[model samples]
Target: MISVKNLYHSYNKDGKYQVKDVSFEVANGEVFGFLGPSGAGKSTALNILTGLLPLQQGEVVVGGYDLKKVSNERFNKIGMSFEQSNVYSKLTAKENLDFYRKLFDVPTLDSHALLKLVGLEGKEHVKAGEFSKGMKHRLTFARSMINNPEMWFLDEPTTGLDPSIAADIKDIIKEKNKEGVTVFLTTHNMFIADELCDRVAFIVDGEIKLIDSPKNLKLQYGDKLVEVEYMEKGEVIKTTLSTVLPEDKRELQKIIEHHDIQTMHTKEATLEEIFIKVTGRGLV
Candidate 1:
């Protein structure tokens, strides 16, 4: 549904690069994530796809239209939500969505229905200015669906919410993908990306460092071993396992047969740990 080749850009045409020789694709009905720390070109790349920023150095084809040649037509097929909440503060939630529904030139989906989809069902008529940060984020999420867009660009979608509220927004993104909407989501939050993105591309200093599914990357880069903690003869025993080795199996067999196993599980890398391994620090 989206394609880019050799993407390169600079905020100042003659200056340092914002994105350099980057390329990736989002398949039809797939959620693709672009992740990086601050100043990592995540937003720069997203802007190029959304037609908000011109691609001065590479080829971009979005929703089957070449970005340079057919932006006017393709713009309608794309939807966008940015880190900053973009809703009109003075308008009620229902009115905010109504305005965008007209702007997109589509028959409006019921406002309350969309509100309900984002967990704001009974608060449709509440003024957005009065809504809390998380609530405003939910309203913006509802507004993005106004056009029933073929593709969506979400940048730092869960920017200003507590854990529970952030999780609620992620759930909505999952639901959107299930309905077959192609999504190009950008964020610095690995935990969020790990949950919602089918595949993620990690970029740093205008270069892509890694691109893969969360599960595959974790398995490939993480330890393939189990660690067992148990008690034997009133003493705590901890054993490190190399799952592929015969000796580890013999040890585990003995533990299963003789000791009381309190906990036994394979060790795996978290997205945060993997990111640090790849780039040396957590997302800023």
Candidate 2:
């Protein structure tokens, strides 16, 4: 649904780029993640794709229209939710969505349904200025869907939200994706990426380090080890045994036969571990 090639963006006349030599593609119904830390240029790339920032160099295309000469009509097919909430403070939650609904030429989702979907059903009449940060964030998220967009650009959609609310947001994203919305998610949260993304790109210092499915990346970089917690001399002993070694397998067999096993599970590399391995830096 989206394609970018040799994308580069510089913030100043000196030509120091924030996004350099970036390239990737998002399939028609795929949820693609751009993973990185703060100032790693995830947002810079996203801003350029969404037309928030001017195209500095290279090519970008969304929904088959060249970004360089894309029309306003093309924008109607896209929706965006930034990390920071942008809502009309004086307007009520319903009013906020109702206002955005008029901006699109396409049909819009119901404002009441959107507010309820984001867990703000009763706050429809409350002025946005009185809302907490998380409340406003939810409102902004709902507004993004006002156009029933085909492609969704989300930057840290669940950041700063409590666990329950974050889960709700994630469920909503999943539901939208199931309905064929293509997602371009930019986030430092590995768990969100791992759960929602079909494939992820590890980006650092404005360049992409790697791109693959989370399952494939883990299989490539994860260790073949089994973690065991067992009773040894009245104490709970926790250890890992390599699954690829014969000696380790014998040791595990002996433990299961002679020792009381408390817990056992395979240990695999997490997305963050793989990211660190690829980029030489943590997501944070």
Candidate 3:
């Protein structure tokens, strides 16, 4: 749904750079994540793709229209949610929804249901200024869906959300994906990326080090051991057996077959681990 190649951006002609030769793609109906730290050019890259900032070099295309030459008609194909809340604090939640109620030409959306879906059902009567950070985030999320575009650009989507609230936001994103919305998400939170992104690109200093599915990266960098845990004689016992080691398969089979296993799980390198190993830096 979105494509970028050899993308580069800089703030000034005196050699201050924000994005450099960055490239990636987000396919239709897929959730593609961009993981990077602050000042790492994530927002710069996002601006270029979203037609906010002029492209310094290379090409960007979104929703079958070249972003560099996109028309207003193409906007219906894209939607965006920014990090900061832009809602009017004096406006009630329903009033906020009512504000953008007709921004699109499609059938008017049922904002009451939308607010309920985001967990602000009864709170719609309250003005946004009185909301906590988490509440504001949820309301902001509801605003993003006002257009029902084909693609979404979410930056730090779960910022200010508690675990439960974050999960609710994640579910809303997943629900949008199920409805065939392509997502180009920019976030530093690897946990959220691991759970929601079909594939992620690790970017630093405006350059992309690697892009791949989390599961595949884990397989590529992790040992093939299944860690087992159990309790015996009031003490915890643990053991590791090669899940992919043919020679140890028999032993693993015997252990599972003969002993009381409390829990067993395969070991795999996390996206954060793989990113640090490749870039020698953390997102923070």
If both were scored by TM-score, which would come out higher, candidate 1 or candidate 2? 2
Clashing pairs in 2: none
Which lDDT values do the candidates have, in the order given?
A: 0.85, 0.94, 0.85
Each prediction's TM-score versus the true structure: 0.93, 0.98, 0.91
lDDT of 3 at 28: 97
lDDT of 3 by residue, 96-187 (tens): 98887767666546889879988998998999999988888888888878788788889889977789998988998999999999998999
Lowest-sum lDDT 10-residue window in model 2: 10-19
| Ranking of candidates on TM-score, top first | 2, 1, 3
Q: Which sequence of candidate numbers ranks them by lDDT, best first?
A: 2, 1, 3
Q: What is the C-alpha local distance difference test score of candidate 2? A: 0.94
lDDT of 3 at 172: 88
